[model samples]
Target: MPDFITLTGARENNLKNVDLRIPKGRLTVFTGVSGSGKSSLVFDTIAVESQRQLNETYPSFVRNRLPRFERPHIESLTDLSPAVVVDQRPVGGHARSTVGTMTDIQAVLRVLFSRYGTPSAGPATAYSFNDPSGMCPECDGLGRTVRPDWDRILDPARSLAGGAVRFPPFAAGTWHGQTYTNTTRLDVHKPVGAFTAEERAFLLRGRGARVRVGNTGGSRDIDYEGLADRFERLYLKRDLSALSRRTRDLVREFLTDDVCPVCRGARLNAAALATRVCGLSLADCARMQVTDLIAVLRRIDDPVAAPVARAAVDGLERIEAIGLGYLSLDRETATLSGGEGQRLKTVRHLGSSLSGLTYVFDEPSAGLHPRDVGRLGELLLRLRDRGNTVLVVEHDPDLIALADHVVDMGPGAGAGGGHVVFEGTPGALAASGTLTGRCLRRRATVKRRVRRATGGLWVKGASLHNLREVTVEFPTGVLTAVTGVAGSGKSTLTGELTAAHPDAVIVDQSAIAVSGRSTPATHLGVMDAVRRLFARSTGTSPALFSFNSAGACGGCEGRGVIVTDLAFMDPVTTVCPDCAGRRFQDEVLRLTVRGASIADVLDMGPEQALDFFGDLDVPEDAVLRPLRALRDVGLTHLALGRPLSTLSGGERQRIKLATRLHRTGAVYVLDEPTTGLHLADVGALLALLDRLVDAGNTVVVVEHHLDVVRHADWVIDLGPGGGRDGGEVIFEGTPRQMLTVQGSATAEHLRRTTV
Candidate 1:
């Protein structure tokens, strides 16, 4: 077998014909600034080629059903193994999916309960909430009930004829509204508030009354349904996924969700809930923390249940080992953060006996505190020691230090990046003159002088989630760092802060919704100005410059690529034959703004675009504002036309911050602004936050990075631990003062990193 996996002449994305050999059966860390082609080389190129080649070995029938991996722009990849990519994308599952179901531990528990419970539940299926026999009939096993918000739906001050129905779909003058207005069951002229008790009941709850509704064509008698009943039937009784996103959002405005009364949020039928093992029901086991659950399972030594119990204990131990001991099996997968979801995905492979596979992790240390990062590092080493090649695209210094081999991908980002600036042991890279090396060698210190608070934003009695009715005050007009371990109440406290101050601007790490057609130009609201500029220069309609409109390439229909589905084969996507990959018609591409075509302009990085528009004398507040914001947020390397989906979590978060930069004297709440950022980039982010504060704004960030904590004017540390052990404020003071504080994990980590 070859000692290394070799790639010759790769040019994916910003890569410039890069070639390298990654050692097999060892841990290799890829390091670079954001958008410097680390992800392009590691994930888009190497992982894609490995998976694509592996997919070819399966039967054609099966291969066609699997996910299609497009061939990377690389020449000759050799000695590749089957690759498993654990990306930062959310572990998206329906409401029925939970930690137990996702990890398959719930299945074993179900079997144990079915066979050993005092009162048997027939079979394993009978213990499953997803199964009809075991499901809560009231909620269909979802554990939550959606009901109409009467206050949001009804305007009692107005009569039916005077627009009493607040829901847009049934507002006055609409067909649905006509039923209530024309019905003889209640007074149309009198205010709904003035109605008698019977009249109000009949208007809201009564049914089967005959009413006449008319359009210009004709009038006809129809059976009238009560307002509440009609709303429930049309919006609540059916699958909301089938509705358009806009419709679903509108419906949600008039609806609220709560625990189902029948299930009481357990999601199980009476028989299933009644079944217990060792005096604890299946739901009870699921609700216990993984760390606690392991002890519960270890006690079950009954010969018949031992194997299943052992299997569950093994899986639960892996979860606890990965520093997720606080998470319960019943926790909803949808509620997990990107980092939490990524770690959970890693858990399944930990128990696998498969060898000679390549495991690729995208920022495994992303959401972890410095203390937990060592645990993640150990996990990576374990994977490497199991005769598998482990590759990580990471920005954390600690994770990089754990690498047996390091490949630093840049001297700068975007057009300036792609070449291997340094490839050696971590010790050598630290001494080298590369950007990553300089960042590693530089020591961060706490702020010498902290800013005084202009006022206080108080969050009192914040008892949500894992919080313990804690009251805290966030100082206004200064930068505050909310530090905590994973599963702590930092997110919950931030939620309360935002709820208390609804006008605050929030820039979170949630993925930006994007499609093949979505780009930075569209997302930052600059596409219209760019289009208008092009149209005015050529004296054509603005639509003529839009790829989604008249200017769309006939061959690709604005997608820039033609996807061909082949029966029993991998679907292929190729650049359009008509307009190349410009996404616009030939004539549209011909139109230029100061010698640069629309496609050419979109292809420019933010810095390049800013320069191009600056030379054209575009108004600063109009087109230049957003471009400057992007550049200020350290995203100068990002191409305007690049799909938002292709960007990293840090880049996306920065993009969100850039869009909201114009606000002044406003409170800004940011969640993990440094996610996916290089060490050097964190400096830039800190500078930006300082600018926000200097310009008279209050900024509070939920972060785990010690540098952010060190630089913060005030630090609010939550948790000496996570979950139940970590809701109270352990320390609240300046970073310098936190160094002397005891028991805080954040404080300890901060002290360790301080020079």
Candidate 2:
């Protein structure tokens, strides 16, 4: 067997004639700023090849049903093992996918209750929330019920015939809206508030009352429920996250929140809930923070229940060890912060004994406080010591120190990045003076003297789960870093701050819109400007330049690709042969701006487009000015027309930042904006932050990048340790003062970087 996995002349994107051999069963970190070939080397080359080869083992029929993996270009490989890449992609599940189902520790909980409990249950099935046998009759398995926002439904002051309901799909005089007002069989001129109790109930909360309507479109039969009731049944409490932004907003306007009457938020039936080993229901155990849950499970004394419960306890312990004990089991998967979601996945693999496996992670220390970095390092080491190859694409110096070997990828990012500039032991790379090395060797102390806040937004007695009686004030102007290990209540704090400053234009990477039509252009609102430019280029109507409105190829209807779901076969998405993957008509493509077509303009990277459009006099609209500012924030490497789905997490965050730059009094709160950024881009990002402050905005960032933290006007460092060991603010000061204050994880990290 080969001693290592070998790659020969691999030419993945941005990778320059790369040849390297990674040692077996070691924690090898791919470093060298963002834009370096680290991700290309670890994820694109090694992990993809291993997964692709493993997929080839099945028969043709079976393979056809799986996600097709095209072979990566490479000469050969030796002693390769099946690879599992637990990337940081959001475990975005519906209301159904939860911690109880994800870790299967919930399965053990079911078994524990079924086997031994205060009251005998039917079987394991009797203890499952998903089981009809054990499920609450009212809410099915979901713990909440959606209701309509009644206030949005009717203008009680307006008369029935005077267009009282204003919501879309139920506009005044529309079939649905007119029926409610016209067929109360009451006078159309009377204000609703002056009507009898029966009229009031029928308008807002009564059950379906069949009625007849006559209008411009003619007569129609209508089953009329209160407008509020119908809206509630359709939108609230349901998982509407997948809908378009307009749909989400419209639904939100008409929806109200409610708890499930049957489940009472328990999400389980009486049999399952009653059967508990230690008087704690399965739901009760899951509701406990994983760390606290582990302690409860260890107290079980019954021999018959010991082994099964032990497995469940061990699983929960894994969660605590990886630094995610603050997360409650009943928490919505969709609501999890990205960094919390990533570590939650890592926690599952800690006790795993699987060997000869290749594990890939994206910035595991992201969103972590400096103190929590040590705990994250422990988990990564545990996986490596288990005889697995742990490959991480990272920027944190603390994690970098744990690597047995390090491969530095670039001198820059985008067009200027992707070359292998250095590779050796972590110690060697630290001394070699690469961008990463130079940064690692320097530290910026917090200013001994501090500026008085232009203003202060205070969160008082803010108790949002795990956060106990916390009160703090955030500076209203200038850059501030909320430094805490993952699950340190930073999100809770931000949530409180934004609520107090309702008009503060909140810019979070989490809330960035996701859709099939969304791209860097749409996300930054630059598509409108591009359309106008196209209209002027050929003197054609602007409709010809819009894919949503017109100018799409007839064959594919402007989708750029024909999507025919194979039903049984895995979905295949091939480039549209008719449009040649170009997405626009030939006539539309012929229109030129400065001798380049609109398609050509989109194809240009941000850097190249900067020079092209710099002198072309683009509009001063919200979109164009922000697009230019996006290019300024080191996004020049990104393509204007690139699909948002194609951008990495870091790229998406930066793109979100560019869009927020134009907002006045905007509170730009980014979560680890430095993720996937090259060391070269850090300076540019800092400049952008400075620009935002200068533009009369307040910027608060939840970050782990040392450079960003050291330069902050203020830092709130959380965690004396992680999970139960962590919670309160351990240190709060400027970066320089923070470094001298011993025992703070942030301080220790700043100290190392200084030396």
Candidate 3:
């Protein structure tokens, strides 16, 4: 077996024909600026090749069912092992997925309960909530049921013609609205408030009544379902996760969640719930934190339950060993922060008996406070000790210090970066004058002159989650940093602040759920103006300039590629032969504004597009305003037509921030705006936050980066510990004052970073 994994002629993304060899069974940390090809090299190149090769080893039929990965542009990769990529992507499963289930610990617990309970269930399956036999009859194991409010969904005061249905899907002129407006059963012009009982029944709960739709020549008779029935079929029964953000937001307005009345939020059925061990039901056991659950499992000494309980305890102890003892088995995996989720994922792998395999982590220290970062480093070393190669792409200096080998990959970002600048131990790299080296020892001083609060919002008796019943005031018109260890209730306190002040603009890491076709131009609402300008110039309708409309290429429609599905094999996607992937018809391509076609404009980056549009005879604010926002947020390098789905989490957050920058006198709540950012990019982010504060807006950032915390005019530190040990306000003052305070996790770490 080769001692190293080697890559030759790797040119994926901005990588400039790079060639390198990495030692096997060693901890290697890849460092670089954001967009400097770190991901392109680590994920798109190495991981893709490893997984693709492994997929090829399986039968064609099996490969077809597996996820399809696009082959990286690298020429050759040697000595690669099967790679397991644990990304920061939310462990998204249905609402039924919990921490225990995701980690497979719950399965062991189920077996233990089924075997040794006083009143036994039939089998392990019978104790599983995911199984139909164990699922709650009312909520179907979801633990909560969504109740749609009719009053919120309807406006009885308004007539059908006046848009009585308040929901977006059933609004006026929509197809669902037309179902009632064209019906002959009731008066379409009449207000619903004046309807008789029969009329109301016909309008809201009509049972397959025939309704006429469209003109007589093109008309068809359709079965008329009432709004309630249609809504249940259209929205309520569908998977909310798969829907667009806009549609999800619309659906959320009329829906409220309540605990299951039948099983009382215990996802298991009555039979499963009736089975108990040590007088505690399965639901009760799940509610206990992992630390407490360990004690409960230790008491169950029945021979049949012993082995099963041992496995459960082992997994639970592994999770607790990683500083996650505060998390409960019943906690939804979706609610866990990126840092917590990543740690939980690491705990899953710690039990793996396999050796000589490669483990890849993307920013394992992300969302972790400086204190917990040391624990993360220990976990990485543990993986290395298990005889696995641990490859991490990280920005945190603490993790970098633990690296057995360090590979630095840039002097800048984007086009200017990708060359391997240094390759050595962390100590040597620190001494070497690289950007990462300098930033490692750099210290940001506390503000000398703290900005006074214009006003304050008081959070009184706030006791959500791990947070104690605490009252605190968030000063307005200043940049405030909320620092805490993982699970220290920083999110809870800031969340309450946002809830109390609903008018504040929240820019969190929640996905920018636009359609796949949605681009920066479309999202910023600038495409309309561009289309109008082209239409006016060419003496055609504005629709002629839109690929989604009349001017689309007839062969591939608006999409640039033709996707061909090959059963039992990976699908093939080829460029559209008709338009050569331009996504526009010949006639539309012939028309141009300032000798540039619509396709040409879409290809331009934000900065380039702004310059091009400025030279043209177009409205200044119409094009420049939105383009400037992108530039202001350091997204000038992004192309106008780049898909939002392809952007990084940091990019998405910045784009969201760009949209809200113009709002004055509004508070801004940002949750880890530094995520996915390079150390160099953080300075730009701090400047952006300064602009917000200078604009007379209160800015509160929930961050773990020492740079962000030290730069803040005011600092609010939460936690003397995490979980049950955390949630109190340990320190609240300027960063300088915070350092002088004792026993604060944030202060302890801050003291180390400062000169």
Residue-pair clashes per candidate, as listed? 0, 12, 0
lDDT of 2: 0.74
Ranking by lDDT: 1, 3, 2
Q: Which residue runs does candidate 1 get wrong by more than 4 Å?
A: 149-165, 169-246, 615-620
What is the TM-score of each predicted model, taking all chains together? 0.91, 0.87, 0.92
Give the range where candidate 1 is weakest over 10 consecutive residues by summed lDDT: 614-623
Give a tens-digit lDDT track for model 1, residues 478-522. Answer: 999999999888988998999999999988876666777888889
- TM for candidate 1 is 0.91
Better of 1 and 2 by TM-score: 1
Please list the Cα RMSD from the true structure of every candidate, rounded to 1 decimal place: 3.6, 4.0, 2.9
State residue 358's C-alpha deviation in candidate 1, in Å.
0.9
How many Å off is the CA of 663 in candidate 1? 1.7
Q: Cα deviation in Å at residue 193, candidate 2?
A: 7.3
Two-way lDDT contest, 1 vs 2, winner: 1
Q: Write the per-residue lDDT of candidate 3 for residues 394-454, one digit (tens) a residue.
A: 9888889999999998877656677888899999988888888887756667667888889
